[model samples]
Target: MGILANTVSFRQYQVLGDPPAGDPGEWAGPLLAKNAFVPIDSGSEEISSGWVCLDDPQNGSFAERRDFFRPPSLAFTLRRDQRRVPAALLRRHLQKAEEEFLAAHPGLHRVPKDKREELRDTVKGALLARTLPTPSFFDAVWDLERGLLTFTGTSPNIAEIFEGLFRQTFEGLRLVVLHPFARARALLPAKLQPLLEEQNRAATDAVLEQIQENTWLGADFLHWLLAHSVAGRNSFRVRRAGPALMDEAFVAFLDNRLVLAAGPQRVTVAGPQDHYSEARIALDAGKEIAEAGIFMEKGEDAWKTTLKAETFLFGSFKAPGVKPEKDGITDEKSEREAIFYERMHVLAEGLQLFDSLLLAFLEERLAADWPKRREQLQRLLGFEEQ
Candidate 1:
C-alpha cells in the first residue's frame, strides 16, 4: 500500500548517514535517475529492481525535482519485476527434451545428468522469455528533515532488498530499523535516557539483538495498554513533537484483535473486546501480547492499526481520510500535491499520537514504583506470580 492510501501498512527506518553538502537534488536527482527501474520485457532476466516515480510506477523518468521531491521529503516507489516459470510446465518440457535426446542416441537408455541439467535450463529460459514479468511496487517516503524513511511493506525479505537497494543507490546512507528500544531511546528525555540504557540487555547494536534483549518494552507496553483499555483509562496527552499540538488530549486503546505469545505457545483473540476474557486467560497461561489492534481518537478524527510488538511495525494503519473540497478550479497535478501533503500531515499526527502513548507507557514503566504498578496490573489481570 502507498502512503497516499487511506490505510497504509509500513515500517520506518532511521537513515544513518548524511548526504552531500549543497542542494540535495544535485545528488539525489541524478542518483534516482541512474538507478531507475528498467523493464525486463525485452530480456530473459528473471528479476529487476530499482526506483520509480511514486505517483507513476511505469514512469521511471526523474528529470525534474517535482518527480520525487516534495519539499522536506523525497517519495519514490521501488519497483521489482520478476518472471517465474511453472515447475510442472518446466518439468514437462525438460522431460520431453530428455526423451527426444535419448531417442536420438540409440544406445542411451536415459539422459545423462549433465544433459538433463542443460535441457532444464534451456526450457526454463524459454519459458521465462515467453512469460511477462510481473511487477510489484513498494512505496517509500524519506523524511529528509528527520532522517527517517517509511517503507510501505513489512516483509523481512523485502526490507532486506530495500536496504540493499537504498545503499547501492545513495552510496553513503544506510537504513536501521526503528525497533522498540531504538524508538524508546528517541522518545526519552535526556535525564531518563540513562535509565533506558541501563535496561538495554543487548551487548551489541545489532537489530536482532536489540529486539531480543528488549522484548519487555513491547510486551509491557501492550500489557499496560490492555490493562488500561479494560479499566477505561484510555486518555493520554501528547508528549512527543509532531503535527499534533503539545499536550493535546487523545484516547488510544487495544481493540478488535490481540495476539499473545509465550515461548512457542500463541493465541489470538478477536472481535470487539468487551471484557477481554480470552486475553486474560492467555495472560494467566504466561502469554504476553505479541500484537494487537490499536485505535486512537482525537475529537472527530480517528486512526486504527495493528501494532506488532516485536518490531513495532504498524499493519493496516487506517488514518482518517483526506477529503479535499471540490474546487473544480484546481488542476489534477495541483490536487494530487495537495492530497499528498494532507495525507502526510494526518499520517504524522497519527504517529505522534502513537509515540505519545508509548511515552506515557515509558513514563510509568521507568518510574521508581513500576514493580508495584506491574504487580497491580498482574492482580487486575488475575496473573499469578510465577
Candidate 2:
C-alpha cells in the first residue's frame, strides 16, 4: 500500500550530506523532472525504474512546486516495471530451435555451444518482447527539515534500488538506514548520549555493524514492554519530542503476534495471546523477541504496527485515518492537499508516540538500577534462575 493508504508498511532512512544551496524547489524541480519515469512498454528491457508523481504514477512531470515539493517535504513515487519470461517456456523454445537446426544440418548430431547460446538469446528476446511488463509503485516522503525519508515499502531489494536511485538523482546525498542503535542514539538526551555511547557494542561505524551488534537494544525493549504488559504496567509518559506533549500519558502494549528468534531458529506466536504463555515459553527457552505487534493509544487516536527489532522497520503500520474536514470544499485539488497534510500530521504523531515509548524503555534500561529491574522482570516472567 502507498503512504495515503489507511494501513502502510515502510522503512525509515536518514539522509546524509547536503543539497545544493538554493531555493529547494528550484534545484529539486529540475532533478525530479530529469530523472522522471520513462515507459518501458515499447522496449524489451527486463526492468526500468524512476520517479513519478505520488498521486499519479503515469504522470512524471515536476515542473511546479506543487507537483512534488511540499515546503520542507518532497513527495514522490518510485515506479519499477519488470518483464519476466518463464524458464520452462524458454527451454522448450530453445530445444525446438536446436532440433530445427539439427534437422537442417543432416551431418550434425547436436547444435554447437556457440550456436545454442545464440539461439537461446534470440528466443529470450522474442519471449520478452511478447511479455507484458508488471508495474510496481512505492511512495516516498522526504522531510528535508529533519533529513529523514520514509519509504512505503519494506523489501530489501526494493530498498536497495530506492537508495541507488536516490543517490543518483540527488548528487552527494546518501541514505543511511535508521537501525536500532542509531535511533537509540538519536533519541537519547544530551546528558544520556555519552552513556548510550558507552554501551555501544559495534567496533565500527558501519550501518550493518551498528544494527547487528546492538540488536539487544530492540530485543530488550520488546522484552521489557512485554513483561510490563503482562504485569499490567502499560502506561508510559512521552519523553522524546514531536507532536505529543512532553510527559503526556500514553498506553502501549505487545499483543496479537510475537516473533522470537534464537540463532537460526524462529517461532511465531499469533492471535489474542492471554498472558502470552506460548511466547513466555519461547522466552524461557532463551529466544529473544525479533518482532512483535505493538499497539499504542492516547485518547481517541490509536496506532498499531509490527515492529522489526533489528532494523526498526514498521510493517503493516495502521495509523488513524483522516478525512478532509473543510466544509463546502468543492475543488478536488484542495481536498487532496487537506487530506495529505492530515495524513502527514497523524503519521508524525504516531512516530512520536513510538519514540516516546522507546525513550521510556531506554531510560530504565540504561539506569544504574537496571540490574535490579531486570531481576524483577525475570521474576515476573518466572525466570528466577537467570
Candidate 3:
C-alpha cells in the first residue's frame, strides 16, 4: 500500500504540464505530418492526424483507448545546485534584502523586523538548495538504437488516449514500426552466425520468394512477417504461442547480439562536423552498455537520440594499424588521426543510407496496404451501403 501511494504521486505530479495549454489542438495537423506535432483548431475544414493503434482484443480493443508506444509528455522543476549556495552568505544576503524591503515598506509590519528577517532567510535557503527536476517530456523522440521512446512509464497504459488523439486530429497521417533484425544480423561477426542460423535461414532470399504467394491482401502484414520468420528457422509449430518463432522476437535477439558483439573496441571519433560535441566510448572500464553516443543525446538532453541515427547509423571497425607486412615511414599519431576521420565519414554515410532504407521500407508497405485497409474500415463503419 505504501509503495502504491508513492508511485501514484509520481507522473501524477506532472499532470499539469503534460497536456498543452487550452485548445491549440483546434488547428492541429496530422501528428505524423510534421516531425514536431502541434495542435490547432481546424474548425470545419477536414484535417487528419497520424496514430499507431494496436488491434489486439486482449489488450483493450474498445473505442478511443490506447497504450502509448512512447511517453506523451512529462513534467519536473529545475533549480540551482544547492551545494553551490552558501548558507552563511545566503543568510546575510537574505538578511539585508529583508531589512531593505521592510524599511522601504514603512508601516506594513508590527512584527520585530530582525526575527522576521531570520525566518525569511531560513526559508529562502531551504527552497534554494536547488531542486531542478524538469517537468518536461521527451515525447516523440525515438531512441533509434534501443527501438524505444524516452520518458515512458510503467504498465498502466494510455492506448485509448493515443488512439483518441490520433482519431480526432490525425485521421490521415501514418504510423510505422521498423524492424532492424536484418540490419543488425548483417553487422555481426561471421563466427557468430551459427548461433542465429535458425532465424537467418528463414529470412533468406529464397524463402522470401516462396512467401510471396502466401501473402494475403487486406490482411495486416503480420502474417507474412511470421512466415518470413519461419523461412529463417526452416520450421516452427503453428500451435506455438507468443513469439511463435525465433525470428518473431527479432528486435529482442538482435539487441542482445548487438550488446555482445559491441564488446571492447578502440572506438575513435573523427569528424569536426560535430567536433565540439563530446564523443562516446562504449565498453568503459565499468559500464553496462549495448550502445553509446557521440553527444549529449545519451545524457541529460536525449530528446535527439534518433536524430543522431543518421550521424551514426552503422557502428563497427576494421583491424587497427597499418598492415605489419610492409609499413615503413609512419608518424603513427598522424596516421591514426587521418584514418579515424576517414572512418567517421564512412560511418556517417552508412547511417544516411540505413535511415533511407528504413524510410523506404515503411513507405512501400504503407502505400501498398493502407488503401485496402481503408476500404475494410469503411465497410465496418457501414459506408459500404450493405
Candidate 4:
C-alpha cells in the first residue's frame, strides 16, 4: 500500500525561532486572511501566484479558531495558472490576420512589425483568458515546543514559496531544512554533544571530523550502507533516546521506471522493484541516489516511504494497517484526525531512523573508515574484484 494518500509527496522543515506570544489561533486569524491566496497572472510564467486558506476563506473562520498555538497546524491552498501561446497556433492566427489585413488594404505590400506584434499580444490575451488556474493544498504542522514544522511537499521551489508565505504570514519566523548535522545532533547522546559542536563550528583541527554544507553526505551514507551491508550487525545501532536502526532491510533504489503491481491480488509496488541491479549500477557509475525508498521498523511499527537523497525528506510514507471503528461507523473529522496522528507518528520514527544513520556516518566512521568501505564496494561490484 502507498505510505500516504491525498498528498503525492512530502517535505519536512523545522520552524526557526520562538512562536509569537498569546493564543496562536487568535494571532493566526487575521494574518491568514491578509495573506490569503489570489489567482495567478495567467499570461506570466510565475508559479507562486497566491495562497488561500483551505479550511475557510470568505468567512475567515481560520482566524476564529485557535489551532495555531495549541496543537500548531495550518492548512492553505496555492494556485498557479499559466497559459502558453503556442508558436504554431500563434503563427497560423497571425498569418490569417495578416491575410485579412492585406485583403482589407490591398495597397499594403507587407504587414508592419508593430501590426504582427499586436496580433501576438491579442492571441496571448485570448489564450490566457480561457485558461484555468491549478490549485494545490499545503499543510503545515508546527511542533511548538520543538520549533519544527513539516510541509507536506518536498519540492524546493514549493518549499521556497512556503517559506516566503510563512514568513509573510508569521513575521520574524523562518523555516530551515533540518540538515544531517542538525538532525543527527538531536539524536546524539549528551556525551557526543562535542561531535555536533565540532561540525557546527567548522573546527578544521577537531579529531571528531566535520561536515561541510551541501555535501552529498546523505547519498554517501546510503552508499556506505550498500558497502557495509554485512557489517551492519555491529556497526549501525542507536540507543538511549529511542530505538532506531538503519540497514539493508530498509533501503531500495529507484532509477527511472517503477512497478505498479505484479501479483494476482493486484498488489502494486509503487516503483520498479526489479530494478535493484540497475540502481546499484547507477550508483557504481557515480550517479547519486535520486530517491531512496526505505522501510523501517521502529517503535513496534513498520513505516515506509521514499526519501530524497539530497535533503532526506520523506515522501509517500505508509503506516501499518488501521483498525476499524467498533461500531463500524466513523465521521470525516475523526478519520482526518486518525490519519494525521498516524502520519505524525510514522514521520517521527522515520526522522529518528534518519538521524541515527546520519550520526553513525559522522561518528568517525565516514572520515576514518569510508575509504576501506569504498574499496570493499568496488571489489563487490567487480570494479576492482582483484
Candidate 2 lDDT by residue in tens digits, 205-266: 89989988999999999999999988889998878678889899999999699999999999
Candidates' C-alpha lDDT: 0.90, 0.90, 0.28, 0.55
What is the number of backbone collisions in each predicted candidate, taken in the order shown? 0, 0, 31, 10
Model 4 C-alpha lDDT per residue in residues 1-386, reported as the tens digit of each score:
12234323566567777667886666766776676665554544424345554433223334445323335454444433345566787788778888898889899998889987887777666665665545456556667767777666567677777778788878888776765555665656787777456445444522123334533556556655544442333233543243344342343223233222112222112454442455455555555554556555644566566665545666676655554344458775455556655655555655665565566666644344656766776565445522
Better of 1 and 3 by lDDT: 1
- What local lDDT does model 1 show for residue 101? 94
Between prediction 3 and prediction 4, the one with superior TM-score is 4
Pairs of colliding residues, candidate 4: 3-317, 3-318, 11-153, 29-63, 37-51, 37-52, 258-272, 259-271, 259-272, 260-268
- In terms of lDDT, the poorest run of 10 residues in model 1 is 377-386
Higher-scoring candidate on TM-score, 1 or 2: 1
TM-score of each: 0.97, 0.97, 0.21, 0.69
Query: Candidates 1 and 4: which is better by lDDT?
Result: 1
User: Cα deviation in Å at residue 282, candidate 1?
Assistant: 0.4
Model 3 segments more than 4 A misplaced: 1-92, 96-336, 365-368, 371-386
Q: Give the TM-score of candidate 4.
A: 0.69
| Per-residue lDDT value at 259 in model 3 | 22
Error of 2 at 282 (Å): 0.9
Question: Could you tell which candidate, 3 or 4, scores higher by lDDT?
Answer: 4
Q: Which tens-of-lDDT digit does each residue in 93-163 have in candidate 3?
A: 66776677668779866437676766675656554444232211111322222332211221223323332
* Residue 298 in candidate 4, Cα distance off native in Å: 4.1
